[model samples]
Target: MRVSVVICTCGRASILPDTLDTLTVQTQPAHEVIIVATQPSDIPDLTRYTAKMPLRVEFAEKGLPKQRNHALNILSDQCDIVFFIDDDYMPSADALEQLSRAFAALRYAAGMNGTLLADGIHSRGIDASDARSMLRNRPAVGPVPIAIKRNLVGLYGCNMAYRTDAISDTRFDEALPLYGWQEDVDFASRVNGEMVQVNTVSGVHCGTKLGRESSGEMLGYSQVANPIYLSGKGHIPPVFLLKLTMKNILANHLKQLCPEDWIDRAGRARGNRAALKDWIRGRVSPDRLTHVRPSPSGPKP
Candidate 1:
């Protein structure tokens, strides 16, 4: 199967190279690598990356889901399998090889899940050599992909691959914009066939704040509102929505009361309050953030 990797990034210029570098060592090299760069300037000279397979970089209009949609439109006809991994996550050396194997094994699967972002040397920050050390010590997975339960929502947005044929004619919903809260669930739920978990296809999400926008107010609102919106559409279960909203609300409130530097608890609490107030007034909607102004730090709209 022709396999491709798509990475959408915004304001993460300094750390993007390291993410790209990790792809360079994939045991089963991708047929192509597509970059949907929200900030064209954030991307360094493409001429420097000769080791990666056929690389294509395009400047995107706006929003993470939109950027991903742009790439999927282009690659859907050209590739059999498409892998979506975040710009902040560094792939293991055998990541693509494992992904290929997983898909090849799951003959009827529409998509497969890759591992979530683990805190790998997050303090030292993301860099080329750090990725090398990360590969050396990355966890190992057995040969087979594990089947994800049917009732479970779906794949992780940070790392996952889809078989183009299995997805039928469905696409990522554009309603979930920018950071696209709960986008993974909305997108993958439309696809038919097996959704398996392949631990071998792993990556380290170097959670660095460098160049990225500080998401507080918008994120908090989305945390409460996005899931509810998806639930209304039958994309998310009310149970998940309930747990997600309550957990984030509690986290935000506790953080606000205690004042922690780790998370923007106070900002999010205020946002939640604002959203809840609007929700109480029957003004809550997924598109409520349509007019949110992108900060100077990241995600230009």
Candidate 2:
């Protein structure tokens, strides 16, 4: 099956090099590499990426959903399978091949997310050498068919693939804008075919800390607002959304009590409170988060 890898980047030039470097080593090279940047300036320098694979760069407005949607539209009638991966991730040598094979075998599955091999998504000091070493001792991933249950949400926008023909009318909902928290769940929910999580299709999410990170306020607000919005639309169960909402709220509050360097507890807590307040006032949605202006030196949009 012909496979195309889609990446939507928001100017993470620092980590993008490592990401592209790792892709060159894939056992089965991608048929095409489509990059959607928020603006022309956001596109990374391709001079370093000398591979012969066809590379396509396009521009989109400033939002994850919009950027991803733009790329999908461009490749509407192309490729058998489209795999989406984050800019800060490094795929194993066999990751693309494994995904292709899984799609060939799981004929009934419409979309799928890959198993995340262990690696620091935010680890500092990682270079091309470090990424090469990490792929050395990959754990054996067994063949497992994806099954559907009400709570079984499978397709993650990051590290997920879908048969080009199977995702008929489904598009990433632009309503869930910006960093697009829970955008994956919202889009996957609308898909008519079964979504699965596969073991063979796996990669390392090199969560690099040197790039633009989501502000606590943005994340916190989305945590409260996105789920509630999705639930109201029947994409998520209220109880499940409640679990997700409360869990983050409690975690932020707990961390506030026992401050951690790694977590922005107070900021996220503020976002959660803001969302709840907005919800009560009859204004709750992903757009609310977009309207919020970031503090100077805060998370970039």
Candidate 3:
């Protein structure tokens, strides 16, 4: 199967090269690597890497969903399967090879997400060098195990793949906008076939803190609003939405007492409060997040 890799990134030009470096050693080289950025400055010079693999770069408006949709618009006609990985994710050498094997074996699966050997999104971010070391030390294993998850609501955005034909006409919803918190879930849930999880086709989500231009306010708002928006759209069940909302709100509130150095718990708590107020007033909408100005004290670009 012809495989394509798509990375929609913003900011973080400094670390993108390291992610691409990991791709150079992939056992199954991608047929093409398509990168969509908001501006030329969002990525590093790729002239040196072009000789190692087919690379294509394009510019788009900033939002993740919009940028990803732009990638879908320009995908090559020869592409069969497409992998959407984050700019900070580092996949193992055989990640693509295993993905190809899994897709070929699971003929009925429309999409799949590999297991994450290490994910820093939940804590202090991991450095690229540390992530590389972790990948190199992972125990050598045989063929990966694959399972079809009928009840999974979405694929992990950092390392997920989909059959091109299966999602050809399915465009990511642009409503979620920048940072698009749960855009992956919203998109994956709308696809036509079962989603699979491959155990051995793993990677590390460096979850580097840079290049995230969205403020804690924006993310916090989405934490509550996006799930509610998706639930109203019938893409996710109300029970799931309630659980997600409560979890984030509770975490933000509790963490505010002794916030993690890497997170802006207070700002997120304020955003969450605003979202709840809006909900009570019957004014909550995912698009409304775009209007919430970033806090001046929030993380820098």
Candidate 4:
């Protein structure tokens, strides 16, 4: 039952210590803590925690998925599961324990699981702003767990777990330009297993802290390109996919209204441009995309 915790971070040094503190208190302390960091100077004083517990920190000189792939690839053979945590998130004390329990239950049941992200939180001004996360805010009355034996629309990588065996050849696709979409879901579906949605446990996702460019935030352009790629792969139904693409375009346009800065405005414009171009091309020049390569083995986690 050894689990390897991978945290992919780039330059968010201040908040990382807090996340590490939370990790130390997990009911099931991870066998190894691997930091796939990009910014070299941001590495913390390891002696503080390492003297008391097992911890290993490493760096990657690439984007999110590439770093994740590198980190996942280097995990020792003894690791039975891989737990992914984004840099900006802090898990509850029982997060790792809950994930281990969920995976154990999945193995016993001969199935897989889909993770539920804490899309909203009362602390730190976190709240769900879109329909995609409308269901994450209910009171945690009890440990409500449910079985969903279907293809997940997507996997929330911020707080997701994967079995070593199930993900034998799985890795996040580094080729995808934006980290915003499709890749995780693509990999999960190709893994060919049952995925359940677990609501019994949750974590705290501190949204967009310190204005860092997490894959989740950047590549907003993926909001448009992703649907096209998915549709080309025939993984997503056309009508629904069309609706989602349109919605993302509208959302990006709306976001353009409240540009945090010039860079944000530029990003929004790029996203909106991608959306409009794809949509218009879908109608007037459907065959114009004959040269774009289809996704290979689909999206990577």
Instruction: Please tell me which predicted candidate would have the highest TM-score against the true structure.
Output: 3
TM-score of each predicted structure versus truth: 0.89, 0.89, 0.96, 0.74
Model 3 over residues 93-173: C-alpha lDDT tens digits?
988888888888888889999888899887778988999999999877667456735447788899989999899689899
Q: TM-score for model 4?
A: 0.74
Pairs that clash in candidate 2: 121-206, 121-207, 121-208, 122-207
Give me the displacement of residue 154 in model 3, in angstroms. 0.4
> What lDDT does candidate 1 reach at residue 165?
83
lDDT by residue (tens digit), candidate 1, 107-143: 8777887775465322434555665676687666787
Ranking by lDDT: 3, 2, 1, 4
lDDT digits (tens) for residues 115-175 of candidate 2: 7665553334345566667677777766653332223564666687889898766788899
Query: How accurate locally, in lDDT, is each candidate?
Result: 0.74, 0.75, 0.87, 0.60
Query: Clash pairs of candidate 3?
Result: none
For candidate 1, the 10 contiguous residues with the lowest summed lDDT are 292-301
lDDT per residue for candidate 4 within 1-301, as digits (tens), equals: 7778888877677667766876778778888888988767767676677865578777776567777887878984758878787766666667677777777765632223334454432223353233124223534534534454444555667776777787777666555542425566655555546655675446667564453442222344566666676677665457766897677666656756764332343454454464456667664122222223322321111
Candidate 1 C-alpha error for residue 136, in Å? 0.7
User: What does candidate 1 score on TM?
Assistant: 0.89
lDDT, residue 295, candidate 2: 46
Q: lDDT winner among the candidates?
A: 3
